[model samples]
Target: MTAGFALSPTALGDGFRIESFTEVGSTNQVALERAGQGDPGKIWLVTGHQTGGRGRRGRPWDGRPGNLAATLLLRPKVELATAASLGFVAALGLRDALQAVMPSRSVSIVPDGGDLRGGGRFALKWPNDVLADGAKVSGILLETAQGGRDGLAVAIGIGVNVVDHPRDTPYPATDLSAMGAGCSASDLFFALSDAFVDNLRLWQDGRGMSAVRDKWLQGATGLGSQIAVDLGGRIVRGVFETIDSDCHLVVRGQDGEETRIAAGDVHFGAVASARNFKAEAR
Candidate 1:
């Protein structure tokens, strides 16, 4: 059994309300349901455990009692294309929060049969994933709903491995406890919420996308390296280039031809395992 979340509205800052649960099907689902019913937004649905949690591409995301299964509901006044960029913002926020909690840890990405990248033990995988020691430590999912007269409400679901991580994953996985960071889920969540707000202010509601893009690249894993992107029916292999202004991934092939992938799954080095690369869950 997991302990109940000890979050209060005041702790979440202004324009935020937290709905805590001991267990839920999925915080994203709950937020979507509320969003469909016209939830004002700026609400966080958090559960200590999730009976039905999901990652990007509908992958099974199990939240242990001590892990975090929370979704932030937002009604940002932006178009769908721009709203998608929030994923980058959320990634930056997670990185900032993780760095604060584990400042001394060095995050490295060593893919299967791949060269290791030097840096902190925590890094951002392109699109939406946080990696610790090449294994995944956090997963992000963004959902949208129509808010009556308030524009589109996006449900930003983030899962962090606080006390436990899945051992049978295609890529290696590790948790804060396993990494020697003895922080509670509540502690991390508080930091995440604050970091997100700070990053959001920097984002300026999508107008400052350039800043978000630049910061994301600084901590991005596998940049300027050979990568394979699975585009569902087909796969593209090339050097992992920079993200375009529109946030599309730009890959430069050996032939010097550039492919601007709007959406696909990305894998560093030669593809050896099946993992959530860069695609979003429908």
Candidate 2:
């Protein structure tokens, strides 16, 4: 959001342009409008401060004062199902970028992450979340909008805790300051843009999501741990087994039945345990 050519992408080949602002209603809204005007390739809009932001299933993602809220828009030449997996690609890219900036932060990128506080326990959560312990540190909301007569435009909205997080939100959250970690929004954005470009290429080349899945599972904190899934109006309690190739979570219910969840709100289950583990840390 802060003006810095050092952070914006000047060399994205022919497929992208960046429109950065210090504050905005939402980057996704702005980028989607551009994609409607036959905006080709990739487009990025990063805001240093956000006034209004949102997440999946219409959840309110507060546009707090200091945080990493950026939207990357692109039109990929792939099936809807396959293109949806790009969110995973973005995660892989973000993981590396965070590592490069906070070298001393106690985060484990690819394997078991110890905690999610400050920089110590930072780790990737399945689908689109980054956590410290069981508390969320980052969240992503990927939206696919149509160009009417044209093709499809995919918008990847990322909300990282660069400074402070939403205090009134229902879910638990964290920020760099809260984790005792240090990072500037400019520094994080530059690194993330670089990573995103490369990750897009990884999917563009058909590397398959095998590697992404492997990395996700390796750093998965709740695998084999009990979790409560909130999918629409239904709530299911179970133990997370594995995230299969389809990007669905295979869960084992208390009834000894196995269920696959393609979409849902995942919580580590039971406030008692989450409290004892200091999952929220709030």
Model 2 CA deviation exceeding 4 Å by range: 5-15, 104-120, 205-207, 271-282
Deviation from native of the Cα of residue 107 in model 1, angstroms: 4.9
* Backbone clash tally (model 2): 6
Candidate 1, overall lDDT? 0.79
Per-model C-alpha RMSD: 3.6, 4.7
Model 2, 1-282: lDDT tens digits are 444624435335635677788789988888888888888757678887778888887877776776778888888766678778877787777776776666534543222232232224556666777665446767788888777667878888888878887676655666767766677777888888787776666566345677667766765566676766667656666777888887788888878998988887666645313533333422
Error of 1 at 235 (Å): 0.5
Reference-based TM-score of each model:
0.90, 0.84
Whole-model lDDT values for every prediction: 0.79, 0.69
* Local error of candidate 1 at residue 7 (angstroms): 6.0
